[model samples]
Target: MIENTSSVNRVAVAILIAACLFMLVPLAVAFVTATLDYPTFLRGGVTIIPGTHFFDNVIEVWQLTRLPRQIFNSFVTALGISLGKMFLAFTTAYALVFFRSRYTIFIYAAVLATIMLPLELMIVTLYQVTANIAEPVNWIANIGGLWARYFGDPLGLKLSLLDTYPGIILPQIATGGAILIMVQFMRTLPRDLARAATMDGASPLRFMFDVVLPLSKGPLIALTLFFFVDGWGKFMWPLIAASSPDMITGVVGLTRLDFGEEAAIPNYPLKMTGAFMVSIVPLVIIAVFQRRIVRGLTYMDR
Candidate 1:
């Protein structure tokens, strides 16, 4: 029985290794393909063997178009999305967990419902909203502008978020999973902790920032990683919202590269190189913080 069990365990380990490698096939193809020369790439459907044009293809991909600008735009937008989502989720979760009222559960339910309505379904609506988005501060600015014009003092608020970074970030910030995770974590905290903080003269906000959030570092960091990855990987929304080349992200730019051109018939290496580079950041982030993620997701008696 012991020998039989040992053999089964070995087989399972082998199978797991095989499955992991199977999952990496596309990534392997991309990297190997990026190394091949244009001519070799055209002839070889999907080369597993690495070739010699790796650096050359990457350099060409970087220089040939607005790839640098597109990458920069993506980084900025992704950072904004992650920070925005974390802020909104943290505040909302805090409110729901600490300041419970008659309608608190209802509000939580409403927010949770939004997770069901993904970006694809609301794409048209979001596009329309973004197309019309203007800062609310502009209303006050308009009055000030007129007053300044009439009285010879100029006050200005020329802010329109549409087709801009802020516009791209805002619509994507309505996150429900973060709130759910936070609320669940908070519920596990001892009521005596809150009472002790209250007695020690900490205001609700102060307690939240100092106590609750400090205790929640693990979960917050994990969620931040997830949010950053999701934000960086966004393609469809950015594609639809930002038609201008200057406004588009790396994903959109690479996808829209002029594959129609005759030269692009064998330009797979350059394209693959760009794609690998774009994916490298997220992959590195996950690898570095994977342990934190596992800890954060594990339910413990905190």
Candidate 2:
């Protein structure tokens, strides 16, 4: 028995070491790629050497690719999606928890059903609906005559919400994952608490705002952080939705470098630098919120 236990422990240690390496290798590669020079990177394709051109590559990406604007767009779109997701999830979960009826079951079933459906299947319909929704410009057009000024010189400045902010924000909001998470979480909350709140003259809204939301902080924060990271990392949708390269987010900017039209030759160093610049904030946020996320996941339904 003693010998068997010792062997098991050794195996577990080996597995842990392998897992750690698997996780770190990609990050190490990306960092090395980001740090190397063009000549060095070209010679060592798919491999990286430690050297000094890190800052130069980063600056080149920023100047050539309009990385700042991409980051900004990413932030804006992520904020909108996360906010919409939070509200929808909270409300859906609340309803499912409080009102267990056929309709509720149907809604939950529908959401679960969507989980099996591939997102690629929905692209055509989504695109059509997106194109049909001509984004409302009342906010911009009304305030400062900005709309006319922006489009007056159409040669240089391209304007429209077709592949713009609204195009990105709205589509993300109509999803069901957030609602499903909220519903699952709300089920864990004691029914007695909601009932007590109701007995104490609290409306459903008050119960949710004052009672449920506070209890849900763990999951909510986790979801927000996830959405933020996902938004920053988003590439395909933004590439399709954004009309101009300038309006595209940093995630898409990385791919654009690969299809080098001129003498750019798909600079790996610059691509990695762009990726790092775009990805660092979301990574930092995940690291900072790592404890909270774990706590939220560990929470029991009791």
Candidate 3:
């Protein structure tokens, strides 16, 4: 007998194929426009075939904003944010899962509540906070200075994360989604396994390091790929937080590429080239770990 689900499978496959084609339209435009000259792009919305200035446009994009420096800064910021989120999420999940406390659920709920309050809602406050990190540092420094008057010379250190890597990474490092993923995965883990590890004299930290982490490889790989994509694509927070040209990221550079000699005109080809280059990191990560990402995502409750 024929399978009854065959018709549904066909419909689903058809939808997916159509969606892929729909998504490819913009990519096709970007590639076409990336190669075209100013005149061709102005005359036509998007060029159908490649033009010779592809390399020239690519070079112009590189020179415009010191593209290499922006790439380096973006890579640093993205990697740092990804690692920081994963670290915090893992630790938070461990505390919520293996350890039992009266306020445990409340604490987890509080953290999860951040999902509703996105960075856009708090950008102004966060900006003020980042701009004024030096105040607390200076306050502590003053205390040390007073102490040093009676003791040895006071050690003075001025700290402000504004326009710095840590500043960019820290504000964006809140890992609500990652924590949720880890918590779900951990729940699927056998409680007896952790108990046995404990009976064998494994400390909580040891159990996590030796037991939970290894079993978490699937989710870890999945989250890493997901986090890398999100981190690499982060724009607004980095834009406001890192106002200095010296610390500006690749995504931030993308915002500046839309302008030309006048507000009415924009360097479409060059902007497309810059946009294409900016996308390379996430594309590479997705291509390489696409399979692991799929497996890890579906690993929940398994």
Candidate 4:
């Protein structure tokens, strides 16, 4: 028995150490790359001196590239999409889990099917549809201040919906992946609580807000964190949907460095610096709310 326990402990320690190294490697590379001297950056890989140009690089990226605007646009677009999806998810999950109907299984299956269809394969058709619809609607909405930035059309600008905020936010909300997650979380919820709420004369909306919404804090936080990261880090969709530099997501913007049209060699150091700047929000979100997420998961498990 003692020998078996010792073997298990050694295996656990080995696994833990390996996992820690796996997680730390990328971070180590990013940090090392972020601080490399520009001239010597191409010599090979991994330098550790911590660049003096960190602030200069950040300022240039922020001022010249309009990273701040991109960040803001991404935040607004992502928040709107995330909230919209969450609301849809919550209601759909609530109905699917709490209500019964002949078509319930069919509806559940249909929702599940969406998860299997990757977004990358669907972009071309999705973009065409978005572009077609955005014309008239875009014309109607861009009459005011920042509205023109997103939905404006004058002097034959034609109100570009392609590579714009609405273009990104609309399709994301309809996908229903987040809704599925919420639904899965909702399934484990005891049916008794909902029944009790109904017995106490609570209406559906009231119960959703009061009972389901309150209990769903964990999934909500987790989803929000996940969505925030997804929205913040999104590259391909933003690239496809929004062409303007001001609308670029962090991942997309960082990728532009490698095109190397202007520079002689790839500016890995600058690229890494920009990456770190973009990564700040997701890190902050995780740092602050990770405990809540763990707690929420624990609650759900119980």
Candidate 5:
């Protein structure tokens, strides 16, 4: 039992409202700015007052840019990344948790260590690997100059993933944080669950699919939405990986909107309009699944 003081409760409510306003005010301003026309925006820069030209700005951006195609690309990339990360994290966590061995802890530690080394820190090397995925194969084939002696030249193979969907999704799927979360969640399950499954003569894979998977549905859904949003918002890697405008993600595509001309003011309203358009999909997703996300993250159902 807990006692709640009325004063404390009122103070907490006030703080929550203030925090909400802090987050929402910027978004409100952006939406209001997006609603303004070029002339109106120029007259009153970044005003909180909403205008009627929101649809007009949206239409102009749609007509002038490749945002539609880029949005599709972002959806595909985000979907792939979400699915791939879930699969890898679930399977790896299952093995680490259920399969007892002397090396299990070591393996988990190794996976956990990767969290400190993010993709941004190793992007240059990652780019090289993506540029020629077959480089490792070529190196192994020519080890000790054996291939060179046999063929009179070293083995040369080239298989680049640059500008491809796999290139964008593959590098990002190996998430240690996801695996760590799954592992911790799985560890909380009763040992009797596994024992009962074994007594019922269920195989490892059967138990995982029928029991673990059902129990993990909430976390999986949460991670999927989380990863989808993360992938959708990716800018630097997508910009670097995709050489062509057609292959860029929506966030990267937004940077292509340039209304500045010779001695002309930059079109803030149109740029905000593009930002709003690019952000709507993920916003809708979060809005629809807000409860599930909260429950999943907190393991409230469990």
Candidate 6:
């Protein structure tokens, strides 16, 4: 057994306390700054002294910004993205793990190769595709002027996914990291379970639903929460994809908060308040599922 010395314990406790303080201090400052009114904020400029206008500022932000609607949009987008990623990852990992084929390694390699091509790198091409999903079909139809010869014009078919939920969620769902994690986790399972399920006349789908899926609850929950937070924090893609103000997300909406005219002093206090408000949902989710998150990540039953 490892020795548990008092001095070592004290040092660990001190480090934990320091880490907590490091994280909380900024939050405290933001809260304090958010509580101050415009005049008080202008004069004091981000003080630790708490003011009494927290509710007043909240009301002002609610009225002045489209944050409420954007928050709802964020919820829908994030939830859809999370579920989509989880389903794709789970099914892909399942096939990679359970299906024995000559090309399995090649397929896994191809899937993992996509991690190199992030959304940012190919965003322009993605936007083009999202703008008109049937572009490929149009190209094929107009190849060698085949369509123009018959119809007297090139094939022009437009099926846009822009400004829609599918456009935002579908493109973001192909997560290689989640698939990798699920594959590694599934590899750790007892091989005899699969053999026994086969002997008991259980089909692959039945075994997946009744056996593997049930045991994978921990990892699934962990991945869902992780993806949800990721989807929620996405700014650039959502900003570009969503043309209308009604479809903007919380993060984008937070940035859109007007800090007054170019000549006037920027309203830092109100902006901080909006930041804090936007952060609430994710913070609450992490706090509520703290233990489960730890357990799932570590793959520990305890």
Best by TM-score: 5
TM-scores for the candidates: 0.85, 0.81, 0.85, 0.79, 0.93, 0.91
Q: Compare the candidates by lDDT and give the number of the best one.
A: 5
User: In model 3, where do residues sit more than 4 Å from their true spots?
Assistant: 1-10, 39-45, 134-159, 258-264, 300-302
Cα lDDT of model 6 by residue, 36-105, tens digit: 9888877878887899988888888899888888888899999999999989989999999998699999
Which of candidates 2 and 5 reaches a greater TM-score?
A: 5
Give residue 286's lDDT in candidate 2 (0 to 100). 85
Off by over 4 Å in 4: 1-3, 36-46, 134-160, 258-263, 297-302
Which 10 residues in a row give candidate 5 its minimum summed lDDT? Answer: 257-266
Model 2 CA deviation exceeding 4 Å by range: 1-3, 40-49, 134-161, 258-265, 300-302
lDDT digits (tens) for residues 44-139 of candidate 4: 567655556667667766765656676777687778777777778878889998997999999988987888887788998878767777555555
**lDDT score of residue 50 within candidate 6:** 95
Clashing pairs in 3: none
lDDT of each: 0.82, 0.75, 0.83, 0.74, 0.91, 0.89
Q: Can you write out model 1's per-residue Cα lDDT over 1-302, one digit (the tens) per residue?
A: 43458888899999999999998988999999989988787787676689998998878877777777888888899889888888888889889988899999899999999889888999988876676554345455567477566766644445445669987888998888877888888888888988999999999989999998888888877788878888999998998888888999988988876544576364777788888888888899899988887788664313
Model 3, span 1-302: residue lDDT tens:
86699889999999999999998889888988899877778877675788888888888777765666887888998888888888888888988998879999899999999999898899988887787766665567668477477666664455567889988999888958889988998898999998799789989889999999988888887887788789888888888888877788988887766434574668788888888888888888888888889889889423
Rank order by lDDT, top first?
5, 6, 3, 1, 2, 4
Between candidates 1 and 5, the one scoring higher on lDDT is 5
Instruction: State the local distance difference test value for candidate 5.
Output: 0.91
Minimum summed lDDT over a 10-residue window in model 3 is located at 256-265
lDDT of 2 by residue, 139-205 (tens): 4354566665767632222243566788877766655777777777778778899789988999989
TM-score winner between candidates 2 and 6:
6
Worst 10 residues of 6 by lDDT: 259-268
Error of 4 at 76 (Å): 2.6
Q: List the residue pairs that clash in candidate 5.
A: none
Number of the candidate with higher lDDT, 5 or 6: 5
Residue 132 miss distance in model 2 (angstroms) = 0.6
